[model samples]
Target: MYSLLFYLALRDAWNLGAIDPTSGTATLLEVTRVLGDMYSKGFRPRRSLMFCSWGAEEYGLVGSIEYVQEYVKVLGARVVSYLNLDVAVSGNYTIRSTASPLLVDAIIEASKMVPSAYDSPEQTVYDKWKKVRWNNVTNEPIIGNGLGSGSDYLGFDQLAGSSNFDASYTFNPADHGNLGSYPLYHTSYEVFSMVKKFVDPEFQAHRALGQFTGVLALILCETPVLPFNVNRYTSALRQTIDSFKTNDSTMFDLLRSATNDFGIAAEEFVARSKSMDVKNPYVIRAYNDQLLQLERAFLNPLGQGGAYSDMK
Candidate 1:
């Protein structure tokens, strides 16, 4: 049940159903087209792939949040990944993505395979994104923007703690004042004409975005080990415990000890994943059952419904 929760539906404020251009016609439509192409090519997926186009995303994440609440049991049990796409290429900035640590490596790998539409076909998406953000001294690619509670991903990640990824190409670091953007955010003025004239005149980024997302989806679908690196998360947890120490040393000791246990468990899982017989469906099922529960390990006890659910 690793879902494709496309929040590109539900454009803002048009009373009856009409064309609302500010939403993700640019991104989601391209993905839909690509899926059709895949189907035509006789491509098949090993595991379940669910596609959901959510509605009423403007006032709140009404559609997606409710869907998760309704199917919490089945989704929580079966969902291993949730790839979300919304407002993917509305501005001039390069690729901006946020990933759970597990999918971070997969996203970087997928970007390298997708040819950049802005540059020549030889240059990859990762090449363009890394060139500006790359640190020459450290020799590491710069990190991407973080995901917040603003989009449909919040519903899945907060409610079920689903491992998730999301992104949008929008304003530069200096353009947070909202200038030099697509300028068609949530208003009736967000017509296609404005998008055509001002923002993404060539629509090249949107095309590249489709390929990038498609490649990532293929990797998740076809990979033997699910592309998850539990060690990445273990490292993250240890770093977090290092910062902002609690007043209670006992609680600190407990947290540190839990991270150690988690590290051991992750190593065992990764070893099992690597050594498992990929030809055996039962073996794959056994491996996935373990991997699917990784998301639940992050859930905090939010108890009853008060206001917001816990996102860990």
Candidate 2:
């Protein structure tokens, strides 16, 4: 359905003389106008859609970030996840999806359902064969890197706290004969003929992308529990502190000594708390209370005055 919609959109733009063969400005404007139409008529109460045709994305993630800051509170929670598809038109049948660790298991399960394009002549049966190396089982798909300040998903993942996935495939990197391939990327030569011939010859990759995104969206809509790992948060925070110390020598020396003393005390406290075990209920409560208090130390004041300072 989405593919048909996309094709129709392209067709309508072409038929209406909206194609600007020069600077790609007309293409952007056409897309923006179509999105605006969709937003006005297609969106419903309790369900909203923001169609963003970002400008200067190649320069940096400026447009998306500005949109995020402007409408974060309004759109944040409703946006369960973000699936970015910048150059989905091209690439191999190979699937690459990257998301937070909380969503990693879900993504792995989804990947297992996607049939691979690789083949082996010796094996008569065409099945999803596991790639092994040095006695180690390797059945994992080529997952891309996590969200950074690059594509459209960056602002949502970083600031708005949305789980974001960027997926693509590089089928035949050596096939330069096809004008529809990488040559059109960020260049003046990108056209319908080249895209139709090389980028997506059969649109199989496009179909696979639609399938992947459909599954992910269904999972998000149906799943009752939102997977969140506190341990991951704790580890990330620890690494951030370590990185800050490593980057600044003067602060490193000062913080290193203080952290050493604090670490010893914290370790001792944790040990004693664990030792309490099945002792008096009051003791257990006290230990749990102390641990909770430790978490509170990281919190900053919510509003007004010097009240926004962290207790720590």
Global lDDT of each candidate: 0.68, 0.45
lDDT of candidate 2 over 14-108, digit per residue (tens): 12121111112332344445545655896322222233345545556566767766765543434555656555444543554555543555565
lDDT of 1 by residue, 202-310 (tens): 8776777777777787788778667777787887677668776578767788888989999999898887677789898778777776776786776665722666443
Candidate 2: segments with Cα more than 4 A from true spot: 1-56, 75-78, 116-139, 172-181, 227-312
Among the numbered candidates, top TM-score falls to: 1
| Model 1 misplaced stretches (Cα beyond 4 Å) | 1-10, 13-23, 135-140, 143-146, 175-184, 242-253, 301-312
Error of 1 at 284 (Å): 1.9
Model 1 backbone overlap count: 0
